[model samples]
Target: MKKLLLATLLLLGIVTTASAQLPKVMLKSIDGKSVSTDTLSNNGKPFIIDFFATWCKPCNRELTAISEVYEEWQEETGVKVIAVSIDQAQNINKVKPLVDNHGWQYEVLLDPNSDFKRALGIQTIPYVIVCDGNGKIVSKHNGYTEGAEEELIEEVRKLVNK
Candidate 1:
Protein backbone atom coordinates (compact mmCIF):
# COMPACT_ATOMS: atom_id res chain seq x y z
CA MET A 1 0.00 0.00 0.00
CA LYS A 2 2.79 2.39 0.88
CA LYS A 3 4.61 1.60 -2.36
CA LEU A 4 1.45 2.21 -4.40
CA LEU A 5 0.91 5.55 -2.66
CA LEU A 6 4.47 6.59 -3.40
CA ALA A 7 4.11 5.66 -7.04
CA THR A 8 0.90 7.62 -7.33
CA LEU A 9 2.43 10.66 -5.71
CA LEU A 10 5.40 10.50 -8.07
CA LEU A 11 3.15 10.34 -11.11
CA LEU A 12 1.10 13.26 -9.85
CA GLY A 13 4.17 15.38 -9.33
CA ILE A 14 5.45 14.68 -12.83
CA VAL A 15 2.08 15.39 -14.41
CA THR A 16 1.68 18.67 -12.53
CA THR A 17 5.15 20.02 -13.21
CA ALA A 18 5.69 18.73 -16.74
CA SER A 19 3.97 21.64 -18.39
CA ALA A 20 3.96 24.17 -15.56
CA GLN A 21 5.85 26.69 -17.71
CA LEU A 22 6.62 27.37 -21.32
CA PRO A 23 9.42 25.34 -22.77
CA LYS A 24 12.39 27.38 -23.94
CA VAL A 25 12.53 27.49 -27.72
CA MET A 26 14.02 29.98 -30.14
CA LEU A 27 11.47 31.46 -32.52
CA LYS A 28 11.02 34.66 -34.46
CA SER A 29 8.31 37.28 -34.55
CA ILE A 30 6.68 38.25 -37.80
CA ASP A 31 8.69 41.48 -37.71
CA GLY A 32 11.95 39.49 -38.01
CA LYS A 33 12.84 39.71 -34.34
CA SER A 34 14.16 36.67 -32.55
CA VAL A 35 12.01 35.68 -29.58
CA SER A 36 12.46 33.13 -26.87
CA THR A 37 9.25 31.38 -26.04
CA ASP A 38 10.17 31.40 -22.39
CA THR A 39 10.17 35.21 -22.28
CA LEU A 40 6.61 35.71 -23.55
CA SER A 41 4.71 37.61 -20.87
CA ASN A 42 2.34 40.54 -20.34
CA ASN A 43 3.65 42.77 -17.58
CA GLY A 44 2.47 40.44 -14.83
CA LYS A 45 -0.88 39.84 -16.48
CA PRO A 46 -2.32 36.65 -17.90
CA PHE A 47 -1.63 35.94 -21.57
CA ILE A 48 -2.80 33.48 -24.17
CA ILE A 49 -0.48 31.65 -26.56
CA ASP A 50 -2.43 30.64 -29.62
CA PHE A 51 -0.87 28.25 -32.12
CA PHE A 52 -2.01 28.82 -35.68
CA ALA A 53 -1.06 28.42 -39.31
CA THR A 54 -1.59 30.59 -42.35
CA TRP A 55 -3.33 27.72 -44.12
CA CYS A 56 -5.75 26.66 -41.42
CA LYS A 57 -9.21 28.10 -41.99
CA PRO A 58 -10.46 27.18 -38.55
CA CYS A 59 -7.44 28.79 -36.98
CA ASN A 60 -8.18 31.94 -38.92
CA ARG A 61 -11.75 31.93 -37.73
CA GLU A 62 -10.75 31.54 -34.11
CA LEU A 63 -8.27 34.37 -34.29
CA THR A 64 -10.74 36.56 -36.11
CA ALA A 65 -13.32 35.92 -33.42
CA ILE A 66 -10.82 36.84 -30.75
CA SER A 67 -9.72 39.97 -32.60
CA GLU A 68 -13.26 41.27 -32.69
CA VAL A 69 -13.56 41.37 -28.90
CA TYR A 70 -9.89 41.44 -27.94
CA GLU A 71 -10.00 45.04 -26.88
CA GLU A 72 -12.84 44.50 -24.47
CA TRP A 73 -11.11 41.48 -22.98
CA GLN A 74 -8.00 43.54 -22.34
CA GLU A 75 -9.98 46.30 -20.69
CA GLU A 76 -11.78 43.82 -18.48
CA THR A 77 -8.92 41.52 -17.47
CA GLY A 78 -5.67 42.98 -18.75
CA VAL A 79 -5.21 39.83 -20.83
CA LYS A 80 -2.99 39.69 -23.89
CA VAL A 81 -2.94 37.26 -26.78
CA ILE A 82 0.20 36.06 -28.52
CA ALA A 83 -0.48 34.48 -31.88
CA VAL A 84 2.18 31.99 -32.95
CA SER A 85 2.31 31.05 -36.59
CA ILE A 86 3.47 27.56 -37.48
CA ASP A 87 4.01 28.35 -41.11
CA GLN A 88 7.22 27.03 -42.59
CA ALA A 89 10.21 29.35 -42.85
CA GLN A 90 9.60 30.00 -46.51
CA ASN A 91 5.99 30.98 -45.88
CA ILE A 92 6.88 33.35 -43.06
CA ASN A 93 6.28 36.24 -45.41
CA LYS A 94 2.58 35.45 -45.47
CA VAL A 95 1.88 35.93 -41.77
CA LYS A 96 2.12 39.70 -41.41
CA PRO A 97 -0.06 40.38 -44.41
CA LEU A 98 -2.73 38.10 -43.03
CA VAL A 99 -2.56 39.77 -39.62
CA ASP A 100 -2.83 43.18 -41.19
CA ASN A 101 -5.67 42.11 -43.47
CA HIS A 102 -7.61 40.94 -40.45
CA GLY A 103 -6.56 43.96 -38.36
CA TRP A 104 -5.49 41.71 -35.50
CA GLN A 105 -3.74 43.60 -32.73
CA TYR A 106 -2.21 40.66 -30.97
CA GLU A 107 1.52 40.16 -30.64
CA VAL A 108 2.39 37.76 -33.45
CA LEU A 109 5.26 35.31 -33.43
CA LEU A 110 6.56 32.87 -36.02
CA ASP A 111 7.38 29.28 -35.29
CA PRO A 112 8.76 28.44 -38.71
CA ASN A 113 10.48 25.26 -37.73
CA SER A 114 7.76 24.59 -35.20
CA ASP A 115 10.32 24.45 -32.39
CA PHE A 116 7.89 26.14 -30.05
CA LYS A 117 4.97 24.03 -31.16
CA ARG A 118 6.93 20.79 -30.98
CA ALA A 119 8.22 21.72 -27.55
CA LEU A 120 4.63 22.05 -26.39
CA GLY A 121 3.78 18.71 -28.06
CA ILE A 122 0.99 20.36 -30.00
CA GLN A 123 -0.30 18.12 -32.79
CA THR A 124 -2.96 20.46 -34.07
CA ILE A 125 -3.44 24.02 -35.10
CA PRO A 126 -5.82 26.28 -33.14
CA TYR A 127 -4.45 25.06 -29.86
CA VAL A 128 -4.55 27.67 -27.11
CA ILE A 129 -2.45 27.80 -24.00
CA VAL A 130 -3.34 30.16 -21.17
CA CYS A 131 -0.72 31.24 -18.71
CA ASP A 132 -1.02 33.26 -15.52
CA GLY A 133 0.87 36.42 -14.57
CA ASN A 134 3.76 34.37 -13.26
CA GLY A 135 4.19 32.60 -16.66
CA LYS A 136 2.82 29.34 -15.34
CA ILE A 137 0.57 27.61 -17.85
CA VAL A 138 -2.88 27.59 -16.29
CA SER A 139 -5.03 26.02 -18.98
CA LYS A 140 -5.01 24.56 -22.49
CA HIS A 141 -7.70 24.25 -25.16
CA ASN A 142 -7.75 22.20 -28.30
CA GLY A 143 -9.87 22.78 -31.43
CA TYR A 144 -12.36 25.61 -31.80
CA THR A 145 -16.02 26.35 -32.31
CA GLU A 146 -17.83 29.52 -33.25
CA GLY A 147 -18.21 30.68 -29.64
CA ALA A 148 -15.05 29.23 -28.17
CA GLU A 149 -13.23 32.53 -27.95
CA GLU A 150 -15.68 33.51 -25.22
CA GLU A 151 -14.64 30.42 -23.30
CA LEU A 152 -11.00 31.45 -23.67
CA ILE A 153 -11.68 34.82 -22.09
CA GLU A 154 -13.50 33.21 -19.21
CA GLU A 155 -10.39 31.13 -18.52
CA VAL A 156 -8.29 34.26 -18.41
CA ARG A 157 -10.86 35.93 -16.22
CA LYS A 158 -10.57 33.13 -13.71
CA LEU A 159 -6.86 33.81 -13.37
CA VAL A 160 -7.32 37.54 -13.06
CA ASN A 161 -10.10 37.15 -10.50
CA LYS A 162 -8.02 34.82 -8.35
Candidate 2:
Protein backbone atom coordinates (compact mmCIF):
# COMPACT_ATOMS: atom_id res chain seq x y z
CA MET A 1 0.00 0.00 0.00
CA LYS A 2 2.81 2.37 0.82
CA LYS A 3 4.53 1.65 -2.47
CA LEU A 4 1.32 2.21 -4.37
CA LEU A 5 0.76 5.54 -2.66
CA LEU A 6 4.31 6.63 -3.33
CA ALA A 7 4.02 5.69 -6.97
CA THR A 8 0.77 7.55 -7.26
CA LEU A 9 2.28 10.70 -5.81
CA LEU A 10 5.26 10.44 -8.11
CA LEU A 11 3.07 10.03 -11.15
CA LEU A 12 0.95 12.97 -10.08
CA GLY A 13 4.03 15.11 -9.84
CA ILE A 14 5.16 14.06 -13.29
CA VAL A 15 1.76 14.79 -14.76
CA THR A 16 1.60 18.25 -13.25
CA THR A 17 5.03 19.10 -14.55
CA ALA A 18 4.53 17.62 -17.98
CA SER A 19 4.67 20.21 -20.72
CA ALA A 20 6.58 18.76 -23.60
CA GLN A 21 6.26 18.04 -27.29
CA LEU A 22 4.60 14.85 -28.38
CA PRO A 23 7.07 12.03 -28.89
CA LYS A 24 7.59 10.53 -32.31
CA VAL A 25 5.94 7.15 -32.42
CA MET A 26 4.30 5.44 -35.32
CA LEU A 27 0.85 4.08 -34.59
CA LYS A 28 -1.91 2.72 -36.76
CA SER A 29 -5.23 4.39 -37.13
CA ILE A 30 -8.35 2.28 -36.62
CA ASP A 31 -8.67 1.94 -40.36
CA GLY A 32 -5.03 0.82 -40.67
CA LYS A 33 -3.52 4.06 -41.79
CA SER A 34 -0.10 4.86 -40.35
CA VAL A 35 0.20 8.00 -38.29
CA SER A 36 3.03 9.59 -36.42
CA THR A 37 2.34 10.99 -33.00
CA ASP A 38 4.65 13.92 -33.62
CA THR A 39 2.50 15.09 -36.50
CA LEU A 40 -0.81 15.24 -34.65
CA SER A 41 -2.21 18.69 -35.14
CA ASN A 42 -5.27 20.75 -36.06
CA ASN A 43 -3.90 23.31 -38.49
CA GLY A 44 -2.44 25.45 -35.70
CA LYS A 45 -5.45 24.86 -33.46
CA PRO A 46 -5.54 23.17 -30.09
CA PHE A 47 -6.17 19.41 -29.93
CA ILE A 48 -6.76 16.73 -27.31
CA ILE A 49 -5.26 13.27 -26.86
CA ASP A 50 -7.36 10.89 -24.80
CA PHE A 51 -5.87 7.54 -23.76
CA PHE A 52 -8.34 4.75 -23.10
CA ALA A 53 -9.03 1.03 -23.39
CA THR A 54 -12.02 -1.13 -24.31
CA TRP A 55 -12.52 -2.44 -20.78
CA CYS A 56 -12.55 0.85 -18.93
CA LYS A 57 -16.06 2.11 -18.16
CA PRO A 58 -14.99 5.54 -17.06
CA CYS A 59 -13.08 6.01 -20.28
CA ASN A 60 -16.12 5.03 -22.28
CA ARG A 61 -18.35 7.46 -20.41
CA GLU A 62 -15.92 10.30 -20.77
CA LEU A 63 -15.53 9.67 -24.50
CA THR A 64 -19.27 9.31 -25.00
CA ALA A 65 -19.84 12.64 -23.33
CA ILE A 66 -17.29 14.26 -25.57
CA SER A 67 -18.75 12.63 -28.66
CA GLU A 68 -22.07 14.25 -27.92
CA VAL A 69 -20.59 17.74 -28.17
CA TYR A 70 -17.63 17.16 -30.46
CA GLU A 71 -19.19 18.75 -33.50
CA GLU A 72 -20.05 21.92 -31.66
CA TRP A 73 -16.64 22.10 -30.13
CA GLN A 74 -15.01 21.72 -33.53
CA GLU A 75 -17.12 24.45 -35.05
CA GLU A 76 -16.39 26.78 -32.18
CA THR A 77 -12.71 26.13 -31.58
CA GLY A 78 -11.30 23.91 -34.36
CA VAL A 79 -10.11 21.60 -31.63
CA LYS A 80 -9.60 18.00 -32.68
CA VAL A 81 -9.68 14.93 -30.49
CA ILE A 82 -7.34 11.97 -30.92
CA ALA A 83 -8.50 8.92 -29.00
CA VAL A 84 -5.67 6.50 -28.34
CA SER A 85 -6.65 2.97 -27.41
CA ILE A 86 -4.11 1.21 -25.25
CA ASP A 87 -5.64 -2.19 -25.56
CA GLN A 88 -3.17 -5.00 -25.85
CA ALA A 89 -2.11 -6.22 -29.28
CA GLN A 90 -4.36 -9.24 -29.15
CA ASN A 91 -7.33 -7.08 -28.33
CA ILE A 92 -6.69 -4.60 -31.11
CA ASN A 93 -9.61 -6.03 -33.02
CA LYS A 94 -12.00 -4.83 -30.32
CA VAL A 95 -11.20 -1.14 -30.67
CA LYS A 96 -12.94 -0.37 -33.97
CA PRO A 97 -16.17 -2.12 -33.03
CA LEU A 98 -16.31 -0.41 -29.69
CA VAL A 99 -15.64 2.95 -31.27
CA ASP A 100 -18.31 2.37 -33.87
CA ASN A 101 -20.85 1.27 -31.27
CA HIS A 102 -20.31 4.49 -29.39
CA GLY A 103 -20.36 6.49 -32.61
CA TRP A 104 -17.30 8.40 -31.47
CA GLN A 105 -15.99 10.49 -34.32
CA TYR A 106 -12.63 11.25 -32.83
CA GLU A 107 -9.55 10.00 -34.63
CA VAL A 108 -8.84 6.62 -33.10
CA LEU A 109 -5.27 5.37 -32.81
CA LEU A 110 -4.11 1.94 -31.74
CA ASP A 111 -1.29 1.69 -29.25
CA PRO A 112 -1.09 -2.04 -28.94
CA ASN A 113 2.20 -1.96 -27.04
CA SER A 114 1.49 1.23 -25.06
CA ASP A 115 4.57 2.93 -26.52
CA PHE A 116 2.76 6.25 -26.75
CA LYS A 117 1.23 6.00 -23.30
CA ARG A 118 4.53 5.10 -21.65
CA ALA A 119 6.30 7.85 -23.54
CA LEU A 120 3.99 10.34 -21.84
CA GLY A 121 4.45 8.72 -18.42
CA ILE A 122 0.77 7.84 -18.24
CA GLN A 123 -0.06 5.23 -15.61
CA THR A 124 -3.80 5.20 -15.84
CA ILE A 125 -6.67 4.88 -18.27
CA PRO A 126 -8.95 7.83 -19.00
CA TYR A 127 -5.87 10.00 -19.18
CA VAL A 128 -6.32 13.15 -21.22
CA ILE A 129 -3.67 15.36 -22.76
CA VAL A 130 -4.55 18.75 -24.18
CA CYS A 131 -2.09 20.15 -26.68
CA ASP A 132 -1.65 23.62 -27.98
CA GLY A 133 -1.67 24.55 -31.63
CA ASN A 134 2.05 24.00 -31.77
CA GLY A 135 1.69 20.38 -30.67
CA LYS A 136 3.06 20.98 -27.21
CA ILE A 137 1.24 19.26 -24.42
CA VAL A 138 -0.30 21.93 -22.23
CA SER A 139 -2.69 20.13 -19.91
CA LYS A 140 -3.27 16.60 -18.64
CA HIS A 141 -6.00 15.02 -16.55
CA ASN A 142 -5.69 11.56 -15.01
CA GLY A 143 -9.20 10.43 -14.30
CA TYR A 144 -12.80 11.06 -15.18
CA THR A 145 -15.64 12.55 -13.22
CA GLU A 146 -19.09 13.69 -14.22
CA GLY A 147 -18.93 16.89 -16.27
CA ALA A 148 -15.15 16.73 -16.63
CA GLU A 149 -15.51 17.12 -20.40
CA GLU A 150 -16.77 20.64 -19.77
CA GLU A 151 -13.52 21.44 -18.06
CA LEU A 152 -11.60 20.04 -21.01
CA ILE A 153 -13.39 22.25 -23.52
CA GLU A 154 -12.80 25.19 -21.23
CA GLU A 155 -9.09 24.54 -21.45
CA VAL A 156 -9.21 24.55 -25.25
CA ARG A 157 -11.28 27.68 -25.18
CA LYS A 158 -8.52 29.39 -23.26
CA LEU A 159 -6.02 28.53 -25.97
CA VAL A 160 -8.37 29.83 -28.62
CA ASN A 161 -8.86 33.03 -26.66
CA LYS A 162 -5.13 33.58 -26.49
lDDT of each: 0.91, 0.95
Evaluated with lDDT, which candidate comes out highest?
A: 2
lDDT of 1 at 82: 97
Candidate 1: the clashing residue pairs are none
- Residues 1-162 of candidate 1: C-alpha lDDT, one tens digit per residue: 999999999988767753599989988778888988898899999999999998999999999999999999999999999999999979889999999999999999998888888998899988999999989887788899999998899889888888
* lDDT string, candidate 2, 20-126, tens digits: 89999999999999999999999999999999999999999999999999999999999999999999999999999999999999999999999999998899989
Error of 1 at 130 (Å): 0.3
lDDT of 1: 0.91
Local error of candidate 1 at residue 10 (angstroms) = 12
TM-score of each: 0.90, 0.89
Q: Count the backbone clashes (under 3 Å) in each candidate.
A: 0, 0
Q: After superposition, how far is residue 93 of candidate 1 from its true place, in Å?
A: 1.0
